[model samples]
Target: MACQREDELQELVDEARKIAYEGKVANYIPALQKQNPEVLSCAITYPNGKCVSAGDINQSFSLQSISKIITLAIVLMDYGVDHVFHKVGMEPTGDPFNSIVKLETSSQAKPLNPMINAGALAVTSMIKGKNAEEKVEYILKFVRKLCNDPDITYCNDVAISEFTTSFLNRSLCYYMKGGGVIHGNVEEIMEVYTKHCAISMNSLHLANVGAVFAMNGVNPVTGERVMPKEVARICKTFMVTCGMYNASGEFAIKIGIPAKSGVSGGIMCSVPGRFGIGIFGPPLNDIGNSHTGMKLLELLQEKYDLSMF
Candidate 1:
């Protein structure tokens, strides 16, 4: 099946590339401003250790907000779901990912979910670490294991740049802190949050991580259990609801599976019981998702009837 798909991968890439220009690169982040907005890349890995990839598959980009999925699982793995949920709600807010409305107005002053900025900050605070560097180290180590790529690394430049311009994120963190949603110094917690966002991956590396989620926390290639199946269930459930920012519903309707997109033009997706896909196209739509990446997934999902719905 993978061999068959490889034959037509270029056709899909060409089709998606046409619309890449409709969206522009995310320039606010200093390090991301230099990305080639026209580049479109994808890699899909099947359970049988087969892979089909095309375009700029070797190019690396920061994980951006997509790191939230793994971090959510990490905190859940360490603290258990009940404790993690106590700090953050289980539902999406339908507002922008960085919006501060619910954190202040909600009765409990909790974040609506872990995938958004406010909730991600709260969840990051829950990671059991004596300091920010230690917490981020744990995440780096675990994500490398998840991807099954020991060399997977963080982009310090991206992290420091985000930290420099993180006024809104800091506001969200401190606001949640005041409400008792997160317990830590605002700067320390925000570092943990944005630091994870800087984890870097090429399309293939990102797809490997997606494969774990698709395979219920097992790496089909190495036969390693990365997390409990129950934990993977929690991750996928959130990916469906909040993974694509407010466009999650649209993505689920169109592409119709679990997926998460990052600001660095990376999208990670899982086709339950089948395969995982990674995409990178720097230009972004109004909703802050990879423009060509989303289009390509829509086309492939439709052609292959991959929608879980």
Candidate 2:
């Protein structure tokens, strides 16, 4: 059965790679603007410990917003879900990812959920650390544990480039702080959050990370409990509700799986008790998700009966 799945995955990858160059790479940030639009990769890790990959699966890329899922998980582990919810709500806002209007106009200015930029920045601020460096180190430790790869490190070039031009994120942080949503220094939290987004990993490593959630917070490869079952369940709910920015509803309708996407052309989709799928293609659709990556997952879900619905 594993061999048969691998054969099918190869066919999907071939089809996905051909369309990878059809979209344009994200140009919102100088760091992401330089990525190769043609790079496409996919990897799937099954519950039985079998792994299948094709194309540029080994190529390293920044985690971008995908880091939000891992960071939110860590915040839940550190502060518990109830405590974290006091600062950020679980409801999805259909508005833009960085919209401050909702935060300002709402009775409570807290972010709608941890998957969005505002909520993730607030979550990053709540992470228990003395300073920016310690906070970043803590995030890296949690990410490494989930990926089961100690070598995972933040990409300095990407971090510096993003920091230099992250005016929107900076504005969001200040607004959150003023609204009492963020309790600490705005710069400190932004540094930690942006740094986490800059962490780099290949498709294979990301698939392992996704598998941790699919396996209910256990690292299937390392047999380590990276997060509690309840936390993983909540995170999965958030992923389904708000993971793909505003297109999450459409994705749920089409793919029927828990997944998250990053601006750096990475998508992490999980099929509980079955497999974790990772796709990378720098080109993005209008909503800041990878066009080809979304198409590939939709195809795989239809072909393999991997939908969670």
Candidate 3:
């Protein structure tokens, strides 16, 4: 059965690549504009320690907004949900991923959810680091644990370019600081967040992340607990609720799985007891998700009935 699934998955990967032309690479970020919009790939790892991949699985890309998932989950584990929620609320804004108007309108000045820029800033502030460098190290350590790849490091070019061009992000950070939702040297925190956002990994490495969620934070291959079950649960909840930016609702209904999409055209999905999936399709759609990635997920779930909902 696994072999049969792989055969079909490979075909789907090929089909997904063809649809890349239907989308466009993220143009707002000057650094990301160089990505080959034709790239598309999928890597899947099942709980039983099997792996399957199709397309350009070796292509590297930054984690982008997807890193928010790691940061939020890590903070929740360290600070507990009560403390974390005090700083960032758990509701979606249904606005652009970087919208600042919502921050001003929010009653308590809390970022609507950890998945958005304001919320991610609040969450990053709660990461238990005494300074910017320590905070980045903590996040990098967690990312390495998830991928089990010590050689991993963020893309410096991407981080630097994002920092230079990110006028709106700086504005959002300062706004959050004023609202009292985020406290710290706003510059340091924003730098830390951008660096984490630049952590580079390929599709297969991302699949391992999904596989951990598949086992409820346990390394299925090693039996080591990678994350607490409760923390895993919260991460999955947010992935379903707000992982795909403004289009999250449609993705949830169509794909019926918990997943997160980054502006870099990467997605990580956890299939509970089945398998973990990571997809890279650099062309983005109207709502900032990888366009071909979204289509591929819909088809895979249809083929295998992988939806949890």
> lDDT tens string, model 2, 1-309?
122456677788778767776688988778889898878888888776567887788889999989999888888888897899999988987898878777877666788888888889888888878999998998888888877788999999898888888888888888888788788787787788879999999998888888889999888887878799998888888889999999999988988889999999999977787778788989998898998898788777767767688
The runs of at least 3 residues in candidate 3 whose Cα sits more than 4 Å from the true structure, single-residue gaps closed, are: 1-5
Ranking by lDDT: 1, 3, 2
Angstrom error of the Cα, residue 120, model 1: value is 0.5
Predicted structure with the largest lDDT when compared to the true one: 1
Estimate the lDDT of model 1: 0.88
**Model 2 stretches astray by more than 4 angstroms:** 1-7
Best by the TM-score measure: 1
Misplaced by over 4 Å in model 1 are: 1-3
- Candidate 2: deviation at residue 300, Å? 0.6
TM-score of each: 0.97, 0.96, 0.96
Instruction: Please write out the lDDT profile of model 1 over residues 1-309, one tens digit for every residue.
Output: 232466588788889999978998999899999999878888898887677898988899999999999899998899898899999999976799989888878866799999998888888888878998899999999998877788887889999999989999999887877788887788898788778999988998888888889999998778889899999988998999999999999888887899999989999998888889889999999999999998898778767887888
For 184-215, candidate 3 gives per-residue lDDT tens digits of: 78788878988999999999899989889877
User: What lDDT is reached at residue 10 by model 1?
Assistant: 76
Clashing pairs in 3: none
Model 1: worst 10 consecutive residues (lDDT sum): 1-10
